[model samples]
Target: MDTAILPLGTVIRRQADSDEQAIRLWLHGKSAHSQRAYTSDIERLRSFVVRPLPQITLDDLQGFADSLADLAPASQKRTLAAAKSLITFSFKIGYSTFNVGAALTVRKPKNTLAERILSHEDITRIIEREDNPRNHAILRALYETGCRVSELCGLKWRDVQPRDGGLAQVTIFGKGGKTRHVLVSQRLHEELCRLRGSSGTDAPVFPSKSGRALDQPAVFRVIQGAAKGAGIEQRVSPHWFRHAAASHALDNGAPISLVKEQLGHSSLEVTSVYVHARPTDGLFKFLNR
Candidate 1:
């Protein structure tokens, strides 16, 4: 902590001096992935600031968000999110007593159409085309458990638990080091058992070609290749599986809270993004009636 760097006057002044260092320290203390995202966000914000941060007016913040509208909706949303984070961080670090960013609003983007889930048939096609047993097991585990690619990559053999004389569940260390249990299908259990015979307990459940834990990009490639082999014309990624699981689970009447927990989301509002309401099944149906 450099006391000389501390600014005089209002909270905003102190924040202008201390906020950048605080944000950097805070980000460094977070997961590497999160650090990368937040760093990019802060840099973008810096580009938008015409004056010293302490001198940035509320109008400037609003104007920056407005300027983002011409970009892709996803990019706009990501930039807005980043701006919100920086503003929030500044407030937390005593840069400003009032949250000027909080008063600013961004338009909500239209939800993209629901992605096509891999039907049992589609799953079968992928599994059949995967000649590598390791790849097969990885896909099965993802499809069966709805684990995020990162969570699956972080998995260890010890995380798999056998119960009732069968492999029953897997303990996943999700984002933020939160742990949750996902039931493993009997077939997946058998696959793990076979895999375990060859790999060590401390080793990654899904290793890369280099024999290290599989990274997110490698997993993405595996899914892409499998989707291509299954004859899916649309691009598919690991996130498609997650969205598919959430949509299917909601369709089958799984409670929203449970789905939120499974997805490791901190807020039910975030989980609601996955629950799609059919136009034909809603109040619109009454109009037709």
Candidate 2:
């Protein structure tokens, strides 16, 4: 018997000799959104665990997890999960003799999707209030397509095309390098065409004044401004449109499975959360006086 633990040849082409190199390799293939999020999460972990990667013990991770008590449950989970992933990657690359984070487990956070969902009326008010052609189109695209802010920001005119009956379709390069095609409403299709004008197909569908793609932060500001202008008291983000899209779709009889594909959800279970959040038929309704 070869008693030694062989390197994971399939996972990586070579061993990561240092923690820094291992960290780079771990984030190498992730989407930009994930890379940014995981970087912040890892940075939070680093502040607590000062020791080198291989030298860190379970106690260190436990203390790090403990430090996250002040953060919201979702934030805590994201931070701890990032640390566990990093340590596990280091171990897999043979940089660490043991996976220090393997024993540490972060509990799943409570679902808050219901709280974030915007009513269709609220969504309409926001869109109807935005007078700028570009911003108006942005709001509609986000709502009608149910795309993530990152996906919307990264969208190019080339990714959109005419389908049958004046409807347009979008090829979204979503998370984990997955590709999903979502149908665009005919109204939105015409709006996008009007916005495109003379711009090249390679140009971003939503471009800044500098002719660059509208980044996520800019899109966020657009959502916030629109929501505020619409007299919405609650804070709004680009994701509100996504939630509204899912919820409103299910409310209007769109199939859950279809919503799953449009949103590029990993599983039917993920798509089902929208249904669960706003269940159409409930026993409580039957008990109404």
Clashing pairs in 1: 12-95, 15-95
TM-score of 1: 0.82
Q: Give TM per candidate.
A: 0.82, 0.93
lDDT per residue as tens, model 2, 1-289: 1121435633333467666788899999899889999999988877778877878899999999989899999999988888999998887776777787989978999998899999989999999999999999999999999999999988998999999999999999988899999999899999999999899989999999999999999999999999999999888999989999999999999998999999999999989889889877879878968
Residue 33 lDDT in candidate 1: 63
Global lDDT of each candidate: 0.74, 0.89
**Model 1 Cα lDDT, one tens digit per residue, 1-289:** 2111223543333434555675664575576667777788667777877565546667988888877767888778888877776776666666645557777777777677454555556766876798778888888788767788888888998888887757577998877878988776788898888877677778888877687899988889999898898898788888777767776777778898888888778899887876653221667756865
Clashes of 1: 2
Global lDDT for candidate 1?
Answer: 0.74
Report, for all candidates in order, the number of backbone clashes: 2, 0
